[model samples]
Target: MVIAIGFEGSANKLGIGIIKDGEVLSNCRTTYITPPGAGFLPKETALHHRENVLAVLKDAINESKIDVKDIDVVCYTKGPGMGAPLATVAVVARTVAQLWNKPLLGVNHCIGHIEMGRIITGAKNPTILYVSGGNTQVIAFCRKRYRIVGETIDIAVGNCLDRFARILKLSNAPSPGYNIEQLAKKGKKCVTLPYCVKGMDVSFSGILTYMEERAATLLKEGYTEEDLCFSLQEHVFAMLVETSERALAHCNSTEMMIVGGVGCNERLQEMMEIMCQERGATLFATDERYCIDNGLMIAHAGAEMYKSGIRMKWEDCTILQRYRTDAVEATWRKD
Candidate 1:
């Protein structure tokens, strides 16, 4: 019956959630939506987290219907994210832990997604295709660590999509990626884009660079934005699917799971499903609640760590901007 609260403001999203045992009690979040043709600045996103964290915390606690004293641990995403935003959430987590006299746990942002996805989908020892704004990796559990078998050499797939959305001046209300998916649905042509797959890893910056140049030429040549969006999605997702398939074959695992912000993409899921079906494998994914970056994941992962006697000393709680998934020891999982 371990109870925990998690604070996650790693990038643009500010999320707070409460979890008991392996079940999510409450999950609430808000994104710092930037204007069209602009990206979310770290400083501005941090400010947004600082201003809204308390309210989000309160909302989560209220919705969870739990007393402050019942919370046994306070957890926060400690790394693999924007430094300023990560620091902002860490501050709130530290303050709450001190005020409530609860233990504090620092969680890896990437591992949080993996843990949550496992809990939600009940997939044990699955090959993970983690795609997000800052990360793109094919992960498998080996000797108590999430080993990255394949990854992006340059910018992540999600970042490529977000930046391309900026080129088209798409709205960031729900998400720039979502807007791109919607536009892609309207496209009829499958314009070819650069697809770079080096061994098991996939590169997106080259695709992004070529697409940007083509967007300029195509827009002037009477090609619609929908056409460009469709081309980008098809090419990028194929790379991801191909890399994931390679990883699955190498690991000799039949189960595949997708996690992180971009894991919410239907098109990506569709492509992955088709790939998995052709190979007689299963694809595990979650809705935005578990797929997207949210406090529930941190809380869920941190609570497991806390139960395993992994607690962070107050003074030792520091932000990690480049925390790799393999850096942390997964003491919670035995298999």
Candidate 2:
């Protein structure tokens, strides 16, 4: 009968969610969107979170239909995100925990996504492909750790798409990547882009650089934005699929779960589904609700950790901007 509330402000989005046991009661969020051709800055993003977090939290609690006094734990994302945004959410989480006299737990951002995916999709011991604005990795649960099998050597795939969207001046209303995905659907030509996959790892910086240098020239030479977006997705997603297949083989796992913001892309999901069918594996994925960054993930992961006897003191609840997914012991998982 444990009740937990989680706060997440890792990047541009600020989310608050409430969960009881393993079921999500409510999930609320707001995004700090920047103008076209621009990315969000940490300080500004933090300011947005500070301004909106309380409202979002109120919404979550209200929607959950729970009294604050009933909450047993307060959770927040502690790492692998922008410094200002992470600190902002941590401050709020700490304040709430102290005010409510509840236990506080700090969760790794990546593990939050993975745990949420597992809970929502009911996938057990699946090889995971985590792709987001800040990270790109192929992972598997091994020896109480989410071991990385393959990763990006440079920029994340989402970051690359976002940056390219900026070059194309795509709207950041919902997201740059979403806009790119939509444009790609209308593409009639497939321009060749650099595909950088080195063994188990993939790289997107070279492809981004090539696109940045040639975007204007290619447009003038009869290439549409849709064409460029289509080509970029084709190459990058192929790279991801290739590495993910190898990871599945390496881990000998039959299930593949995709988690993170970019996991919302239908084309990527379609591509992965084809690969899974060929490999005789299952693909587990959630929609934007669980795929993108959200507070429910933090609450879910934190609840798992708390149930497993993990706790944090007030003094120990600090942010780690570079926390790795493998650093946290998956004590909640026995197998």
Candidate 3:
């Protein structure tokens, strides 16, 4: 009976989870965005985590109705995130583990997402479409390792969404990503945006600039905002779909799984599902609990590692700003 606690502050979201064996006992998450309602701000992010990490952790434990003394292990995200925020989580988890005399395991944020996706989709060797404000990639497992087949050269898909949402003044009144999706629904016309595809690498900054210029021109002519949103979603989603399909073809993997923040988009999931179906590929997603950045993913992953007697040394797990997904070695015991 291995009970584990997981803390995550790797992104704009704060998550805490308690796990018993391989099942989640309780999972909690709270979101805090940046100042001026823009993208994630490191200073503000650190401050937010420092302020609320403890409350969220305690609340999660209470809500889960779990006893702290039963905890045998503790896990915390160590890197691949805002340094300030990740540090905040590490400090908290370290303190808690120290207090309880529990051994702490430092988890990789990207691998956390991938492991959660595996749990959600149950796709043993699926081709991965991972996109977020921080990462955009086409990945697959090979030779006991995750390989990055393709990715964006500049600007992740979610960052493009957030920036465009700011450009349209959609940050305050409603959620930026959700608002942009709504606007895209109202858009009736399509506008041609720059498509930069270099082998497997795609660049969204150039497309973003073109769309911004075109949007300004349209606004000058009183063009509808809905149409602009629609065109943008169409073009961006098409590019993603094209690259995903190409990766699938290259890998010859017919199973597709999406992970990351943007993976929450119903529209994106629908598009990927349709693409996967076209090629007779099966697609699966999280069952709410593992969908967003929740501590459950980390705890669940840690529980798996703990069961196998795998652990990370505190001195070895460094915060990585430009860490690639393929860099981490896989520990899954293939039966």
Worst 10 residues of 2 by lDDT: 1-10
Off by over 4 Å in 2: none
How much is 62 displaced in model 1, in angstroms? 0.5
Each prediction's TM-score against the native? Answer: 0.98, 0.99, 0.93
Q: Pick the candidate with the highest lDDT.
A: 2
Model 1 whole-model lDDT (C-alpha atoms): 0.92
Global lDDT of each candidate: 0.92, 0.95, 0.80
Per-residue accuracy of model 3 over 1-335 as CA lDDT, tens digit each: 88888898887889999878667688898888543446767888878888988889888899879789888889888667788888778888888988998888877777888888887677888888888777888888887667899999999887888888777767633346667888887777777778788888788998889876677788777668788777777777788888989999998887998888778777788899999989999987764457667898788777777887887676754456656677766776452
The regions of model 1 sitting more than 4 angstroms off are: none
Per-residue alpha-carbon lDDT of candidate 1 for residues 233-274, written as tens digits (9 for 90 to 100): 999999999999998898999999999989989999999999
The clash count for each model shown is 0, 0, 2
Candidate 1's TM-score reads 0.98
lDDT ranking, high to low: 2, 1, 3
Give me the displacement of residue 152 in model 1, in angstroms.
Answer: 0.4
